[model samples]
Target: MSARIQEPRSGGEPRRGETLIQQRNRKIILCAALDEFSAHGFHGASIANIARAAGLSKANLLYYFSRKEELYRALLTSLIDTWGVPLTSLDPDGDPREELLSYVRRKLQQTRTMPRESRLLANEILQGGPHLEGETLESLRRIVQSKTDLIRSWSAAGRIPHVDAPHLLISIWALTQNYADYDSQIRRLLGEEADISDTPQTFLETLYGSLLAS
Candidate 1:
């Protein structure tokens, strides 16, 4: 079963069966919320600020999202669903090495493309994920458990070297997410105007390739 979050549109697309204006406003609000939430975490972010950022009145924003917590959680749910897309595609029947490598590549792509979303999630987690408590947390755990079990099976079958499945997954997340979460640090070291390279993709694939070799 896919572990993707199946919540109705909240912070993302307009809810089903809404007028076009409502759909447009929801999209605008979500984009603005992403900016605010990324800049300031949940506690520091406010409905007023998000409303101003969205070019809507506080009442208008509230009409779409009744509460700040509601808006924040909706945004988070949408992000997790987006991130889960690549993860859900990790095929147990595929060659273990290739499957894992492809996962690494896709994660790196997300790191580069969805830096704000990545940082937003990082902030939530660093703060103990106060918003991601109920079903969201359960689904995340279920997905991680499923992937780890698959990794363990690969190890048992001699498809890959004996490895700590959970830590291996954690390492992949840390390696990929650092590129976005600490991008300022990376820029400071590499120089602001310097041309970025595809070293992350090359280095990660090569590293995991060796680590997963049977």
Candidate 2:
């Protein structure tokens, strides 16, 4: 009796026997690709390096993703999904102070937890937002507009002081993510003792109180 060879699945259909090893390999490739893209940017990262980092041959890496661009897109999409959670939580029905404070805390937590992803996004923006064109840009714009509307409503209802809603959102993002994106400068200026996470609550409390106080 001869053993039968199994074929891998594609296009939303499963093969007869997709092993756990294949699933694990896919995850490893993704993790390695993220680190590589984050460190080198899309133009600088190489498939061979990613393959070596992923502990797979270039051919095997290609088996999961057809090309380098495909892998980079997958990583960017994953980052965007994770990065958008806090933004999506800005609530119109919630108390303004609590809602904004929660947003600040969540942004700070993401900064500490996913600094690499922040850096990757910064790199993408610095490179002229090449990968984030068309529908990607439109989707992001829509989300920003929705949040800005909520901010405007908060101001109109006297829940918060008057401020440019879009600019306010920009400012909040800048202040919170600056520590992570500019960690080198921050570390140099403030020394190792400076902890961003410890200061967000206090800083936000003071800032928000001053800005929103009647």
Candidate 3:
């Protein structure tokens, strides 16, 4: 990991006088920390490694985040904020095919923009979601349930073909994220220039068309 310096916050919140340098440093630390944690998982990652990656000293990094777990939680919380964007975009009034296609596109975009974050999330799940306990788990469950409900509503309205809504969402997630989450195998199978994002739009058009067209 690289070393990054964060601007110190006074009085527990941003003041009118905060400089761009502080914000930039904070971002650098977070970005470096995300990369380190993604590559090493929670237990395997170290504060020194994260500080080195962020271009900051261990003491400086500690000033920004008190503990490793705090930094980990901050990263995960940031991920959850951005990760929910696609789901939040599902318009109840939009055409089902168009909506689903948009969702797929948004997910692919995330894969391209935040592959490290996606991998970090996948690592957490592989470890049985240990970090997402109590309120965090409940929040996630509620969000998933809400999206599942939307899918169910679409199916009931004859806007989409009947399928297990939860499973359908899961399939969409699996198919789209496979590119980022399994890049090595995909690269080996399809070659370097084979872009997953390029294929998803047309592939999803065909898939949903076949599945939903009456």
Candidate 4:
């Protein structure tokens, strides 16, 4: 019989090794940095703040991420993965309304779970996407373009309305993200209410259910 070794999993305890320790520490730092960067925009955010939030010395945080920009980039990269997940499920093989509505539903849930991440991205873009320019922007553009093309193809095939695919997609993104980025305003407007994202989520279903009705 051959012995097997388990590689460390994300968010799990580290093994008895230096690399595992580094990985664990890196994860910790990134989580704290995500909160800090989300609360304060990039320039307003700092290495010292992230280190303090992570309960580590500035030197220790630097050991994992050498610079503020590097750490910010890392945070952006992770956020992209999280943000992209729901959109990536738009399958050409599925029924258009079902698939599209599923995407919107999941995105609504993400806003509830990842409101900080949503706000962070919004803040970055509002600041003209300094870190998000170049390769990052290009990669994001490519993904959006490909999905836009898919929607266009569906429209051409009469699978959905002849609505402008890009515009429709943009509407979905804007509508869903608003709940997260403008949460305080929405909550205040609600007046003495729990933070129930479902109100908007349900509204979206009814709205899109009508808008995309074939």
Best by lDDT: 1
lDDT of 4 at 206: 93
Q: Which 10 residues in a row give candidate 4 its minimum summed lDDT? A: 1-10
The TM-scores, one per candidate, come to 0.91, 0.86, 0.85, 0.87
| CA lDDT, candidate 2, residue 139 | 70
**For candidate 2, lDDT tens digit of each residue in 1-214?**
1111111122112224768887667777776776787778989999999899888999998987888887777667666656777988988788887888788889888888777778778889889988875554567678888999988988898888897998888888888878778998987888977776787668876896678675
Between candidates 2 and 4, name the one with more favorable lDDT: 4
Error of 3 at 13 (Å): 7.9
Model 1: weakest 10-residue lDDT segment is 1-10
Which runs of model 1 end up more than 4 angstroms from their true locations?
1-13, 194-197
Tell me how candidate 3 scores on lDDT: 0.75
Better structure of 1 and 3 per TM-score: 1
Can you rank all candidates by lDDT, best first? Answer: 1, 4, 2, 3
How high is the lDDT of residue 82 in model 1? 76
Worst 10 residues of 2 by lDDT: 1-10
lDDT of 4: 0.77
Error of 1 at 46 (Å): 2.4
* Residue-level lDDT tens digits of model 4 in 1-214: 1111112122223435559668767777777777778889898998898899777999998877778888787677667656776777889899988888898999888877778789889989899987775555566677888888988888888888777888888898899999889888877888758556667778898988888787
* Candidate 2: residue pairs that collide: none
Give per-residue CA lDDT, model 1, range 26-107, as digits (tens). Answer: 7778778888887798998988988997889999999988888888888898787677767778998999999989999988
Give RMSD to native, each candidate: 4.3, 6.9, 4.0, 6.3
